[model samples]
Target: MFTEISADEHDRQLELHGPLTAAVRRLVEAGISTGADSETIRQAQLAVEAIAETLEQQRHDGPRTMRHAVTGRPVVLADPVIGVRNAIAPPLTVQHTESGRCWTEFTLGAPYEGPPGRVHGGICALVLDHILGEVASDGLRQPRFTGTLTLKYLRATPLGRLRAEAWVERIEGIKAFARGQILDDEGVTVEAEGIFIAPAWAREAG
Candidate 1:
């Protein structure tokens, strides 16, 4: 996985010592000197970057976590499940919670850029599966594995920052049904459903 650095860190570094190298300053100055259009473009980009950095810094905790039944909360798992949970844990860049439902909020950066600067649909599915599965089992404790996942892209999810919510709809014997949605500030961009299996090992352990 790539190490995520907050935009605020970039801004803080910029402010604390100014542009570290003359190269950056030179680039900006050159852009400014080129023409009005260039200056306008540069300023616009810089302002956006500055805002992103500031927001990222302010949300240093990463994603926000929510515990709501509608969102499917994660069950507390034991042993190896605990280890995996910890290892694959969402970045401080994203929030996570395991109550009746499970949810986490975080921003994706250039690394996750699929279509230009927007988040890819497949990535959204990946998140939905994990979150929905976790909620299916209630978290580390119950530990449900993904048997099937279906995602519908209602709209393109932007790359910068995003919010996601997931929860279990119901459970039938060994199978758990779950659903989730991803949203930008505007509204929902992706909706998903998942069928998770509670492995025999996990069930036995529990």
Candidate 2:
């Protein structure tokens, strides 16, 4: 059974989530870049432990998936890719266009940087895989797993504001073909194509 949450409550949770995630990101960045002494490091470790304990005291008992029926999107607070509460995400804002395309605008900061100022190639591939798979899934009405993803790095993606766009190219039987690209201020930096497969369970859902 799906979990049900009030829309107002969800909005409230999201409002508090933004600053919480920002703090976690700051913690990660500082942990990586700081050159403090051993004593300071020890103090930081203690502070981290205290925070972990506080969170553990009121943790969810199990995993839950929540969706909004109207928008065909997950509840923002529970979404991993763009959840304000999830620290792992760059938390891009993905929107569906009227022309059957998906677009997201976001920035990768210090934590996501590689090659002295560029976004990591693997991360670029990851983002493409997700967006392409989303396009293939047709807004989750027909869920698909990425069978294969191919990416070409046309140029180094700088570690700042960027855009990603994806659309379905074709669909045949259980396979959906999709393509996506990541763009920086200058132009396209990475392009990708993917084949996504709807498994038996997903096909049954549709």
Candidate 3:
């Protein structure tokens, strides 16, 4: 089950996190493309070590369940697809509409590039899977695990800002069916469908 936190507290966490995560992401981008001298590389490595040491000194055991530390949301903060603090994430932002649709948008950087400047096909599938699964779970109200996911790539997705939308197609008992699509500036580049099943624990909890 998802933990509960005050909205004000969540906002505070986001405020505190914004600059820190941005700095880390910038460091990651620089590390990926830097053509620094040996001395510069050594200095950077030492700086990273110092940061790691500070983190280790302050570390404490965290929650066992996969939930966002700040928002208490069901989504994992370490997830590569949508984690707010994950440097590897395109860091997709999902917005749930009252009309029962989930919309997401993000820009992919060089780290997510494949086939020249285009986004990787596998990455497209990953993002679709997550969005479809979110729709299946009804915005995490009734948690479900992905059972089957199928995707079709219509065209290569460019490595810049992308958008995706997903919605539940049907639901029967503990099973949910969903459909989604990913789009770039040109148009839809990938389409997907998926079946998700409520895990035994979730069913029992419900």
Cα lDDT computed for each candidate against the true fold? 0.61, 0.83, 0.81
lDDT of 1 by residue, 144-186 (tens): 7889999889888987677778887888988999899888899
Per-residue lDDT of model 2, residues 26-96, tens digit only: 89889988999999999999999999899889977643456664554556455556767778788877778
TM-score-based ranking, best first?
2, 3, 1
Q: Could you tell me which 10 consecutive residues in candidate 1 have the lowest summed lDDT?
A: 75-84
Worst 10 residues of 2 by lDDT: 69-78
Candidate 3 ranges beyond 4 A from true positions: 64-75
- Which pairs clash inside model 3? none
Q: Pick the candidate with the highest lDDT.
A: 2
Q: Output the better candidate (1/3) by TM-score.
A: 3
Off by over 4 Å in 2: 76-80
In order of listing, the candidates' clash counts read 30, 0, 0
TM-score per candidate: 0.55, 0.89, 0.89
